[model samples]
Target: MNKIKAYGTESHKDDLKEMTIERRDVLENDVKIDILYCGVCHSDIHAAKNDWGNSKYPLVPGHEIVGKVVEVGSAVKDYKEGDIVGVGCMVDSCQECQPCENDLEQFCEKGMVGTYNGKNKHTGKQTFGGYSTTVTVREEFVLKVPTNLDTKAVAPLLCAGITTYSPLNHWNVKKGDKVGVVGLGGLGHMGIKFAHAMGAETIMITTSPDKAKDAKRLGADDVIISKNEDEMKKHKNSFDFILNTVPVKHDINPYLNLLKIDATMCMVGAIEPLEPMNGGNLIMGRKRVAGSLIGGIKETQEMLDFCGEHNITSDIEMIDMQDINTAFERVTDSDVKYRFVIDMDSLK
Candidate 1:
């Protein structure tokens, strides 16, 4: 084991502070990463505050991690020292499960180990995430990052990028499909970019008219103010697919009304319970609603490859590790333009 420098909150209500944590020695199938950048996800704030009720204290909450490989175990043939790599929301899963066999380890039947706040399958110790100087992960769970894109901006792709990319790729969204990306936050922004890049006529569905211009700049082909009665009615039953990225509970019935018969709307956000929906909305049109989690390792690599090809990366603001507490506050207040990433060198 090695004591590594990191920043984490000791209590739910306490501010994040500098601390030292232990990382296991590299195992036969493991790779040790010198973490360069880690994205600040909204879920990080949620975990830090124990909002989901499963958070463990002294939490190191970053999952969107990007860095360079400093060491590789003898059995790790796919990665080498000096190679760029990444780790997302998951670090390990039971490989015997059907999901794991199918390359969908995110749905591992035995429960996938999270990057942080999860029990390590091998050591039975709490996993520390990427808000630190280094991390050691299994080769299968580690990702090969494309060197072509902006390394700093590429960190969010591990979480926000893959979270939005999975649903679109699974649904096989294609050319000329009229796709609606609900909300304009981190997830929603990536949804728009993916839908547009996939050749769909992407529309931004939001309550704020002021966001329309910014949404267009992010690849949205058009804007629909959901609060406008005439505008909502005009586009009713016209969408081929809708990706709902609203993080909080709200009435989804209206968004339901915008889908075409036989089309589906997938929820990638708002993990909480939502208000009851009118059954008629779905029964009458045969429209469907579904949910998706982040993609598995194989698919995450694909998303990274796609991003590399298209030069896609999140709109991010860079911050020193010391400012993470303030960054958390800004994220809670919805004050950031999009996402925040920490430069781990600041900790040195």
Candidate 2:
């Protein structure tokens, strides 16, 4: 075992602090990464604090990882030392499952091993995440980072970027599509950028009119203040597609009623059990509400390639490791611009 410097909470109530964790030596098909920047995902806060009810203690929660390949096992064929790479929410899954065979490992039947607070399939040990200085993952689970993108900004691409991109790609969003992105935070910001780059007429729907200018700056051709009945009425039955990224529960019917006939809305947020929906909305307009998790390994790589082609990345506020607690509080209060990224060098 190799000891590496990291910052993590030893208990659910404890704040993150300097610590050392053990990383297994490189095995066949394993690549060791020297983590550079780790994006602070909202889910990370949940996991770190055990809010989800399943979180394990001594957790190091981060998945939006961008790093350099510092070592590769002998069996590793494509990657070499010093290559830029990334790891998302997943680290491993049962490859023989139908979902894995179909390159949708995110839905692996046997349970995909999450980057943090998940049991390693092989050893039944807990897996830590990118809050650490280094990680060793299977080569197949690792993704190639785009050579030209801003390495720091690109960190969120692994999680936030792919989370939004997969739905847009799956729905075949094309030029002239009227796309609605709900919310204007980390995930929503990426949705707006991706929809705009896909040549769609991007509209950002938010409760606050204050986000209007910021939405336009992030590539929304138009911004609708959803709280205003008149503004909401104007876009009724208009959107061809909607990406809902709000984590809190709200009246989804307004957004549902605003979808054009046969239009589909995909959700990348709201993990809690939602209240019953009115079937009338769906049956009347034939609108569909679907949900998507982060992309599988193959689709995630494709998303990265697409982002590279379009020069898309999250707008992030960089912070030191020590500020993670404050950042979590800010995130809960919705006080951030878009996303937060932790400079791994700060941990050292």
Candidate 3:
């Protein structure tokens, strides 16, 4: 065991602060990473505060991690010391499961292990995340980072980027498709970039008209104010695909009406039950509503490769590790332009 410095909330009632965590020693198939940058995710805050009622105490909350390889176990292949790499939402999954065999480890039948707040199969200890100084993970869960992109900005790509890219890639969204990205936050911005890069006519669907200019600047070809009846009706049944990124509950009926016959609307946000939909909307058009989780490891690597080819990275604000509490508050208030990434050097 290796004891390392980290920042974490001791309990739901406490603020994140300096602490010590134990990382497993490098096994034959493991690679050790010296943490550099870690993106602050909304779920990180939720887990720390026990918002979902499943948070473990003394939780180190960060999964969007990017760092450099400092050590590789003897059996580790495809990576070496000093290589830029990343560790996303999953650290381990049952490799023998059907999903793992299909390269869909995110849906492992035995339940994939989260990067943090999960029970580690090796030690039976609660897994800690990237707010720490170092992390040792299996080679399979470590991703190859694109050295061409801004290293700091690439942190969010591990989570937000993969979450959006997976669905677009899965549905085969491509040239000549009209893609509507609902919401304008972290996930929505990436949705716009991916859809645009894939040659889709990307539209930003939002309730706020003020978001239009920034939406366009983020690669959205057009903006649709969901509140405007005239504007909503203008694009009725014309969209080939819609990627809904709204994390909150709202009437989805309006978005459903915008899809063409047999077209699909995928929800990447709002993991909870949505506002009741009018059955007639789907019944008449044969429209489909689907949801997707973060991509599997193979797909995440593909997303990274795609971003490398297109020069895609999240627009993020850098924050010191000490300011994580403040960053968490800002995220909950939706006060950030896109995402927040911690400069782990400050923690050191």
Instruction: For each candidate in the order shown, give its overall lDDT on alpha carbons.
Output: 0.94, 0.91, 0.94
In model 2, what is the error at residue 146, expressed in angstroms?
A: 1.0
Span of 10 residues, lowest total lDDT, candidate 1: 120-129
TM-score of model 3 relative to the true fold? 0.99
lDDT of 2 by residue, 1-348 (tens): 889888788887988787888888898889999999999999988888888899887888899999999999999998999999999999999899999999999999999999999997656788999998999999989999889899999999999999999999999999999999999898999999999999999999998889999999999999998888998898999999999999977678889988999998888999887667888999988999999999899999998998889998889999999898899999999899888999989877
Q: What is the C-alpha RMSD of each candidate to the true structure, in Å?
A: 0.7, 1.0, 0.7
Error of 1 at 145 (Å): 0.9
- Model 2 TM-score relative to the real fold: 0.98
- On the 0 to 100 scale, the lDDT of residue 243 in model 2 is 97
Please identify which of the two predictions, 2 or 3, would achieve the higher TM-score against the true structure: 3
After superposition, candidate 1 runs with Cα above 4 Å error = none
With a 3 Å backbone cut-off (N, CA, C), the pairs that clash in candidate 1 are none
Weakest 10 consecutive residues of candidate 3 by summed lDDT: 42-51
Clashing pairs in 2: none
Ranking by lDDT: 3, 1, 2
What residue runs in model 3 are displaced by over 4 Å at the alpha carbon?
none
TM-score of each: 0.99, 0.98, 0.99
